[model samples]
Target: MFNEEFHLEQPIRWGMVGGGRGSQIGYIHRCSAQRDHLFQFVAGAFDVDAARGKEFGQNIGIAADRCYPDYKTMFAEEAKREDGIQAVSIATPNFTHYEILKAALEAGLHAVCEKPLCFTAEQAEELLALAKKNNRIVGVTYGYTGAQMIHQARRMIEEGMLGEIRIINMQFAHGYHSAAVEANDQGTKWRVNPKTAGPSYVLGDVGTHALFLAETMVPNLHIEKLLCSRQSFVKSRAPLEDNAIVLIQYDNGAIGNLWASCVNAGSTHQQKIRVVGEKASIEWWDEHPNQIVFAEQGKPVQILDRGQGYLYQDDEAITCDRMGGGHAEGLFEAWANLYRRFATAMDRVNHGEQASDVMNEMWFPNITDGAQGVRFIENCVRSADEGSVWVEYK
Candidate 1:
């Protein structure tokens, strides 16, 4: 058994590879890590650009001495410290994930990287092996998995409260289309650049969240085949696809549809998920993230709050119930919660102690999920390129 005593004294020391000034995702990652207070960021190489790296460090209150100019500097300097960073959060763009992550793991540091995991499946495989060989922990942030109420929804389904699941209808669309891809100069910059963004456009970014949610709630779920279509509605945008639609089938005969577009107007993150089961149906959405709407046959609709007195079979479900109702928790908090879990896992592994419930449930996304996500993006692009024929997932 792991010693609770050991876990308490040693907090996870952390650093950052990206997420410099004005970076949306990096800000989210920092807020999330701070929320739990389980991980203490001791150092960072916040930006790939030197000036921005220093300025970002100053802006975030990260000390100059600990804020290095590049990831290489951060790794080399910190690894020499007796109090070096135990982990590094990679908030860089998609393409940078693999190399930065590989270095971190090799240096005996754990990693909490933002998603789409890696740019390719092969990189994902190699990283997984490196992590195993080093006995290091890695987590990919699939935001929906950490959302408070999503846990309750997953638990209800797992406990058979919703009966055998049949189909999932998940739709997430936003009006950021033009704002994201057309905000020329700096607007459509890195995100639309193929060199930085790696592959598809809006779908690779937001669509992954939709896929992670569906995959998490359903049991024995393996994405069997997928049919996808892409669109460059703006036509002349550089770097990535601006819009896309994907059809997915799970191994157990369940089907799902996902659509993402950056050209669509007047939409403000309109997202919802509906799961139809033999016993009942449940619905949840980002707009009303606080509750999951559960409806059973011939019964009034029920709204379940976070952290209420509910029995949830999954660790994530229990996490939701513990947080309770009326306390609004969103993206940043969920991200923080994942970091807290990462701290727990790191403490277990670093101290050479036995694992706990958090480790057992594998609450955070790992190497396989990362690999799967890369394949997912590749297939989506391939299907779109090949005239939208269904593509098989390897």
Candidate 2:
């Protein structure tokens, strides 16, 4: 169970770049950051249009003067303030992430960025270097890993309950884009455009989420090589795949497969991961995030629920459970959990403490994880473009 009393003496003043009106992701970021009273929404460059951005900021109770027209202006003007924003969340298009995040770090502000941190691994590394040099925290939103059950799985695996891990299957397939919906949707439009979405569509978009989940659960496995096949089911979105499959060979001799698609007809967010070990296996589905299916080699299957006494209560991850057993908790809570960690990290830096000092006590996806996701996309695209042949994981 989460401790409601956990909070900072003063909430971290925060701002945003993008995620204006009608942006679902923007709204989610706001709700999650402010949910635990760890962060306070102080300002934003909410939209590309200056006038509309200022209006949206004021409409959401932010002062008119604080809402700048662009991130550059926001960073400049905020720096002069005694109560300037200490952190900012980058919720803009994928292509803009690297620049905005770079600017924020240079301004000495911590950041919470949407994933695939940048287009290339080189860019991701640059941002990582800058963050370290500036002593700022860069949080990548791999939101699902914050779920209490995920921590339980991690604890179980670490305890040797799963024995020698053999196979890992992961996927984040949905049917929302079975057709050319981007023809009518602006949000979806940018995603299918290489200029805005980066190298591979589904591979970087949904695939990274699933990949991070597997990484969080089985922390010991490292990809040795991989083979990838991708397709642009919606013809208009050529050069940007709407579906992709990746086969990974782990350094430990464990094999893994990832299926990421936006064309899984009739499905609704079928994001799942199943890890098989010599003695048992455990599976988790985002649709039913509260429970995990556990099957031992010789016993009947068992369903482990969140907040149950049987869970690894000693694990720090399990401490994120916001509600007791029967009540439901979903993406919002998971995101909030990540945000809370981000805040703690930022707060530590603010007090002249290293964010890594408390790593064993708390864990959150940092810049290194973000860089790895970008590299994974790079590898997948490399293999796919080279006639879908096996390639070394760089």
Candidate 3:
């Protein structure tokens, strides 16, 4: 049991599963978990292959005695230790999230799993059930939620600055599948596989991030109906569609457009979002993630940067700021902030600290976000499969 003072004063014990040498997302998670000084990687099974796992663990400075051969061994032995990981970071492929998270939860450890949550809606639901059954925390690292600017955007909308939100436009595009790589590049291979990554190519990959931001910020917006079209421009490049366009209708009579593609040339993660409302409008781009653009009648357009003091100070958003104003915080730090916030909350619970009435009001993305993300993917696929019919989400 750890108190708030004890928690921040001492690092939380943490472990990693997967993210061996050259694994793309694995490095990001590891870097993020280490950035805030809130977490310490006490153990890990960094690869599917035993030798590779040990090698990767050593490369990352994990002790050999603590780097076990498999997640099972790592979980079993760590549970016996008096000082074990308080949480585990799952950086494995999309398909492995459920199994790895289930194991961690069963071991009485909280989890920070990378996104898409599960390969299927059913699997995602089961994982949600398991988390409750084990009384463990499961947070999918939707890194954008950690951005200071995003918190500001959500605040502006929720505080009625954006009265009667009307529209959301979002796009996520990258030029990865077109680039040449190994025939079976472990990094690229699994992402393209349907069984592993689930439906709709870039939809689940970067699309989830876009959906998370728009839905989180816009008020009274729901995906009432969706019409989608998908394409695989690169000849059998990835089993999933390389490009997709989706049209959505919100329950509050608002509408949205989503465009995602992996085949787009010269676009290096050009993720952008725009929200329009009666009182104001806001826009954000992932390439310039630290800043948001705000426009409203009778006011000069404002550019809000992450980690800088906002026009309106929000403690939840402010706590995520690392350096002084003008210094930029990147994607990795955003992820770290989420973990730090989760640790702060869990530490309060561990020490018998009465939970804050507004803990749920904080910016961290929870299980509901996970469920909605999966639902969004499902809706996109259903629309595309049914000859681009406008399918209702519910």
lDDT of each: 0.76, 0.92, 0.77
What's the C-alpha lDDT at position 382 in model 3? 82
Q: What is the lDDT of candidate 2?
A: 0.92
Runs off by more than 4 Å, candidate 1 = 1-7, 179-181, 185-188, 311-324, 353-360
Which stretch of 10 consecutive residues in model 1 shows the poorest summed lDDT?
Answer: 1-10
Q: For model 2, how does the per-residue alpha-carbon lDDT over 1-394 read when each residue is reduced to its tens digit?
A: 7889998989999999999987859988999999999998999999999999999999999999998999999999999999999999999999999999999999999999998789998898898789878888889999998888988888888888889999999999999999999888999999999999999899888999999999999988999999999999889999999999999999999999999999999999999999999999999999999989999998999999988888877766786678888688999999998999999988888888875564444689988899999999999999999999999999
Poorest lDDT segment (10 consecutive residues) of candidate 2: 353-362
Better of 2 and 3 by TM-score: 2
lDDT value for model 3 = 0.77
Look at candidate 3 and tell me the lDDT of residue 245: 90
Displacement of residue 386 (Cα, Å) in model 2 is 0.5
List runs of model 2 lying over 4 Å from the truth. Answer: 356-361
Error (Å) of candidate 2 at residue 216 is 0.3
lDDT of 1 by residue, 1-394 (tens): 1122323466688898888876767877887776656778778898768887887797778888998998988999998889888888999877788888899989888888877667777777888788888888888888667776776777778778878778888777777756544454453466677877788767778877777777767746788899987877666654367777889888878887888766668888877788998889999888777778999999999988776656353454345322446767676666666666777778778878533333455666665666777888988888888898998876
Candidate that would win on lDDT: 2
